[model samples]
Target chain A: MDTQPFYVAALDGLFGSFPTDADSLWVMLIGSLVGASCALVGSFLILRRLSMLGDAISHAVLPGIVIAFLLTGSRNIFPMLIGAGALGLLTAFLTDSLHRYGKLQSDASIGVTFTWLFAVGVILISRFAGQVDLDTDCVLYGEIIFAPLDVLIIGDNEYGPRAVWMLGGVTLANLLFVVFGYKQLKVCAFDPELAASLGIKVSLWHYLLMGAVSMTTVGAFESVGAILVVAMLVVPPNIAYLLTDRLGLMIALAVFFGILSAVLGYWVAYWLDASVAGAMATVSGLLFVLVALFSPTHGVIARVVAQRRLGSSTIEFADSAPS
Target chain B: MNESSDLPPWLEFFTFSNVNVTFVFLGCVLLGMSTGVLGCFAFLRKRSLLGDALAHAALPGVCAAFLLTGTKNPLIILGGAMVSCWMGALSVELIVRYTRCKEDSALGMVLSVFFGVGIVLLTYIQRTGEAAQAGLDKFLFGQAAALVDRDVWTLGILSVLILVVVAIAYKEFKLFSFDPEFAAGIGLPVRLIEIILATLIVVAVGIGLQAVGVVLMAAMLVTPAAGARYWTERLGVMLVAAGSFGALSGGLGAYISYLSPKMPTGPWMVVAATILFVISFTFAPRRGVLPRVLRHFRFRRRTAEENVLRTLYLLGEPLGQWNDSFSTNELLQYRSMPTAQLAHTLNRLIHKALVKEPAQGRYALTDFGVTRAARVTRLHRLWELYLTRKLEIAPDHVHDDAEEIEHILTPELELRLEALLEHPDEDPHASRIPGRFVPGESGG
Candidate 1:
């Protein structure tokens, strides 16, 4: 009975008493913040069709983090952000260069560039195993459970987990960036040439958006890990996309779903006694599946029903109606 | 082997008789080769990142297999990996085909989500305290040093199977890669072939997981093929080159890890493959950056020289003095080329024995230069005439188009243009179109 399967355990926890402990609250807060920040920036990434770029930046930031650790001899947030931000931009630049100048296909260029950078990062971690506190597994799947333990003690006054403060700051920054740059980002995403003709620097907005994504990814990385950060970046936004036609609504919905998954995922992890970040990502995936199949406007089921309704309509009306 | 142990560490590492090293080396090479071969299909289909998605998606499958069988059997685990990888691939296809999600988004979503799920399953397994579940986490980042004889044999057999399937279905795959619609029109079973190739890729990714791990397996599949593309135009040549590159990187990566006990094998393999990609991208004969840049430079220089010679001919046109001298300033007035460039072009022409500095700061066309200049003028005029008379573009609009084409027109194109226009004698602006350069003839 103690060795209950994961699904059964998860079901039990869903109906069972919810953990209201401070630690669990802290974990859920950090998770939701990470989710919100990632979703805010990821909406723009999906709009730009640069979702893979988000993935690439997430992986490629590893070496930057490692190098920053080596140079600073500490895991201070600012240096890590700067290092990872620079490397994130470099990954974007290199992938673009390889695609445009080197004439490699976009996917291959992306695949080659990030994996190479990630490999270098792994080697650095292994070579400096003694000095570096990071490992490949930790980079892939983070230690969210220990977030509360790494308390930010400022001169004997104990604050909560550092991740909460870091993620909150990032989420706020991402919110501001997205809110302020809405018009510019929308134009640039929908039509770069038109945006350029309108005197908006498309590349500037591009890098700015990429910069925001990098910061969000780095902030979320401690709680969700790099791979799950990608999930947070892509899945919720896509789910929102399926539900809405307006960009503003889409972004809002994405953030809503993101936080929903985060809280639900914490409970799931609690029930299954597994990784919190992974459960969050899985819950998001399941959410996306649900929305994809059942959204009113764009869901698969709606489309099929619409098709059947059209098929049964009068021929003259059906012929007159534009597809 | 015992005697070799007393040798220096570096020397001792290279001795092939060491059984463990042999197994590791063979496993990686075979893994590299198979992935490289399967990657071509994916790359051609523009699905390079699909390999990454499949690799990441395999993790939960691996954990699920261990949980189901409660054994550490490699075959069973890999079997589970294939099933889930196939499922991931199917999900990607479904999302792209039926939904509004773009392929890239679908790939990213599936990749990260499946990997997350896998992480959940793996962590669950760890908490369960399954005795046989030791070292399952190695799939996260492969530990190639743990390769034994049985693993080597499995990798070897799988590599051969991938190679054989690719070879036997070579024609179908080539058709499928280049033009699926045409292949289907010709009665080929396009769907079945796609499934087969997808299966092959799934297996290739499956085999590579233990050697290269989930994150890097995409590099093994993509880098070799991408590097090989820069080196060859033919599909057959690309496959061979990619396979060789894959094998070379695998062996090199294995050796590097052998030398440094602390360094992991998978990353080094990726690094080695990337080094090869960089080399190929830079230095391959035709498609490489170096040659492409060289070609562009050469073309620019030729355009400049030809423009100068054509200007000299136009300047001398009214007087009919093909041998008349012209200063740099005079040439720039007619051509708008930079003054310094005109002088440099004159010097190059002098070296070619086509133009001579009859006086300081002044140039004259040699007999050869007049003939070459006439050829350029003629092609320029013929294109203008063709455009105005046949395509109905304004004569003014034709000159700008002809300016670009005059430098690029091959001799065959020049002849074709002349024949099409019936060797017209004058351009739209009333400038006489010069004849083809005949070495012994008088200058036009």
Candidate 2:
């Protein structure tokens, strides 16, 4: 009864049975949204040399989310957002202060602050497991496969999965922030002293950027988990950084890389029956490796080839000069 | 409730009568010591997060080891972790050296990518429907309770082997950490020493994976060394102290986990290490916050008193009457200090017999105070003249520098400045430079 061609069926199988239904589509949509938003904010992080801060904020937000859950007895979005933003700011503040006043090195300060907060988060989750819905394993890798089950119901009308709506909102907010504060963010990332001299509140912009990272992280938490959020927050931007020089192009390319990773990662997970978030992160990482090795301007191969070419040309010039 | 009810009495827990507890405790101790020692070098080299990347990168290796052997043997899995993490470290080094990416970006890339691969492999393994795969999940956050005696023995031996390597290459590692270029210039095989050090760290991290897990193991490596740094300045002492702190925290974590069935050993151990860090950060004798703050306050108080004395001496300079006692109001005219603060400074000086109230609301310098004021004013003027004459600094810009330097300059520094400035009799402002205080001098 099937009228489809053999190549189409084979392609479908190759894409892990493509022509995906509503559930798979929602999963991919959410993955792309998470990837895009993280990449949008991550471009600034990479430029600012604060890529590791993204990792720190993602891990440190755990206790804030759990405390918000325990207090409200619900996974309401607003409270969780506020809690995560506050904790992200706290992580930045603590790391800065420890480096400045405690006479500790920058990496050591970051390592101490995030690890302590994360440990507390783990302990709180385990101690209050009976009272809250989160568990250690879910906190680590997440359970994005079951995301579609929690649909949003509004006045007897059933919408799609709640993650799509939340992630969409986060993506839109991130886009708006980037669009409006693009110049200020660029100035601050390239040179904070210049931004300050230009009357921009550098610390305020830093916190605002951190707030965006926190919001993106919290929105992606349920679907991808904390560690994978870190991956999305840094990997795409890293890849884009290697491929281009212009900030605008870098942002655009990072989003493209992020979406590519999400789509490919979803299919990889579907085919291999592995964690979807994990596969996405792996894909993003692979893309980074590819760019690092083969990008036209910044790639390792190109640099080596250029060096060799220059060496041979210099030798030829010397050979001719002897005549 | 069932788990807690099954636990032995509190005394039995402390006594370590259980063989499982004994093995776990010993294993954690060794893990702590090796990580602490190796972490010192990592921290000194500014490669703290490299340990983190290595730890995250080890997860895939662990899963690969499990898949290849179809076994959960700690030794076998750890060996796999070591190989993969070493590769990850090498990759990071290459990326930083050969590409435009900085160390931080390279580290973030390797850490997340390798961890993602591990997570993927782990998920696949979890779905394989094998009973032996049950314990493999423990490596994510660590399950010290699940470690057997054989696992303990393996970890202990590997940890000791790492320590021995560190001890054998101590001086070379020290040189490599402090100044790699100098070591290389001296023909010390700097690259080999660095590779050896990196391998030792990988081994230390590899053995610790079973007790602290891949996620939190960096804390074990970094926290103990950071804490130990607060207590000692010598590398030898720091190494010993860091090892002890590591062992104590490890043992304490094991004991606490035994007491509370719900508490996982890894996080508890981290909590313990953090507590020690907090203690060292706050209460250590020299580098701690408390002592530093106290010393700062003491210096501030001293500076205030000396400023008041100098102000009184300057107020009498126009009249050329060093012995005349000046009222607080007259003294206030020369300095912009608050009335309340002036009174407090005068009170402290009176207690020290540096100044006295010859009349109500009037202050006068004592014989000893005259010499002290002369010394302070001499140093201030000497620095001002030095700055203007030698450094070609503007007169207006030299006062602020002299104000701070006057309080901190040692006697030897004053002699050097005096010689350098050829014992100038006047400052850049044309004010007479007071001579160095002589104890037997009159009130001239």
Candidate 3:
């Protein structure tokens, strides 16, 4: 009852007994960076209407990481990331191909591809669960608490967690892609066939966009796990879309919403003594719902209000018209 | 032979030996039957894959129910899944009706957003450290091996209830699904019928959720329908075929995983269903690829014969004088046509008796051919006038349409077309119209 207040929960996490300063700051920074990365990439992803692919790739990355560990016999970040990203790319391509060539609908093709792929990963993890340190059950439901333990050092000053660095690198790469190909991506997203007719090479752009999503998603997967990664990709961009019409403004709003969710989620989780990823996803979901229902121009409330106004205007016009 | 034959009797056997296997088999068969019936309507309505979105939407529902009731009782969890899935279906329909977004986007957005919420709730449960929460996460990916007897009872009873509803409302559901515009015109409750169909699918998916998980539940509803589509166009046949396919796949997937202990049942079930789809995709009776290809080839051959007659009629003497016989070299050289193409055309002409070889390199049309050739040419000229005169097409548009229409134009349709055009003697280009086939006129 005493911890019901928001400010009290924030203060507790800031100087909590359980997680020391290093741990608290690192988890928050890594979580926010991962949050921002998913938002930035997800901005274009949602625009391209590829959020489902984002979900599939993120979840499907588990077996890739597991397989990478088995081959390299090392638990380092670089190899595992490359392996996972490759798997993500494969899932994206396979899903797109199945829809395009195999004539399966988007959800069915994606559902068939990912569940089968993830099932493979889970089975492998369960099989070698003893030998393999990381398991898919942990992967599907992420464990952000252990993230702070995997720290990266930069000389005597020391640096943030490895997850923060990975997510930061991905965020930087995603930002560059967005900036460099903004116009092309926009044109392609709007009318793909027109983009093709205009010689924009839509297939090339699609693969490029999907590659960026897979890369950033795999990087974030190491931190929040697959399920939370999906929430990050979907919720923030959707909130940003609710806030603005312009792509630039939308990305900014998404990053803002995402970072805001990370901070609030960490505090809420600390007070409630629950999972950080769950809090972040729930907060993000709450933000999305609020925006969906209340954004001035596009929200559900705005729609209903506009309908009423139109109804009144029609009657007035009808009364004034000459019979 | 068949891959199933290669396996040992123990592995290839259909059902489980003990009560565990029997219950699961019976439950899956009933589940398959229910979904197949509902899926027929869904597919007919062209929203074949909405079931996938609803299946994932059930996740947050189950989790929310757990949070409120503090129980993992099958009924409670099923209730939770049903509520959310129902909401998801509503949201999908609302988005499509309200927004300018295309159907795919509407489906994609609803699926992603609902699934995102489900993931959040699922992860929240795992992090809560509840003692009974061990198998709760399994709902996300489904684990058929864990399905006990009571679960089977719940699934079987629900399936029977749905089957009964489908049977009682068969006529209404069919008419509504196939042509709602007409059904509405006839005063049928199209909206209520659609709702019932959707509710049926939700119930079936909710039951399957325990065994297949969110990911595979969509396939359970769609793959069987897709596979069945190849075998028949009739609704009754399709429903039965899909149900059988679903049942067989579900049993095989469960039996495979049970025997191996390493593989999961859901994916294997999808594999079996996909295999059936592939079979149907290749070899279905009327619409199969092979039949389509053969039909296309035959049409092309027939079209070529008609074109040969039209060309002979245009180039030959007006009174059908030496039209049949033409030099092979001259034929190939006339339009820069390939020599092989000229040969193929000549061979077909000889086969059809329109043209013949009197001697080496000498060709002539029979009396039968010349009259037929003139009739075709007249049809072409008449169509040309009809296009330019009756249709008010430009002189340019008339020729392009007439060029193609002349060959396929049957005598009966041509007479009707000419009558409709009010009988013109000359085309827009001032070319003389050929005489019509009257009593005892040429080939008439």
lDDT string, candidate 2, A30-49, tens digits: 88888899999999987776
Please tell me which model should have the higher DockQ, number 1 or number 2: 1
List candidate 2 stretches off by more than 4 Å. Answer: A1-20, A72-85, A125-133, A320-323, B1-17, B127-132, B394-397, B438-444
Prediction-by-prediction clash tally = 0, 0, 4
Best by TM-score: 1
lDDT of 2: 0.84
The lDDT, on a scale of 0 to 1, for candidate 3 is 0.73
Per-residue lDDT value at B194 in model 3: 74
Computed on C-alphas against the true complex, the DockQ of each candidate is 0.66, 0.59, 0.26
* Between candidates 1 and 3, the TM-score winner: 1
Tell me the spans in candidate 3 whose CA falls farther than 4 Å from its real position: A1-51, A56-177, A192-219, A246-248, A309-323, B1-19, B41-50, B59-129, B171-199, B229-238, B255-262, B285-380, B403-412, B421-444
Better of 2 and 3 by DockQ: 2
Candidate 1 pairs with clashing backbones: none
lDDT of each residue in B372-442, candidate 1, tens digit only: 98888888888999999889998889989999999989999988888888877778887777767652224
Could you say which candidate leads in lDDT? 1
Clashes of 2: 0
> In model 2 chain A, which range of ten residues has the least summed lDDT?
A135-144
RMSDs, each prediction? 4.3, 3.7, 5.8
What are the fnat scores of the candidates, in the order listed? 0.88, 0.65, 0.18
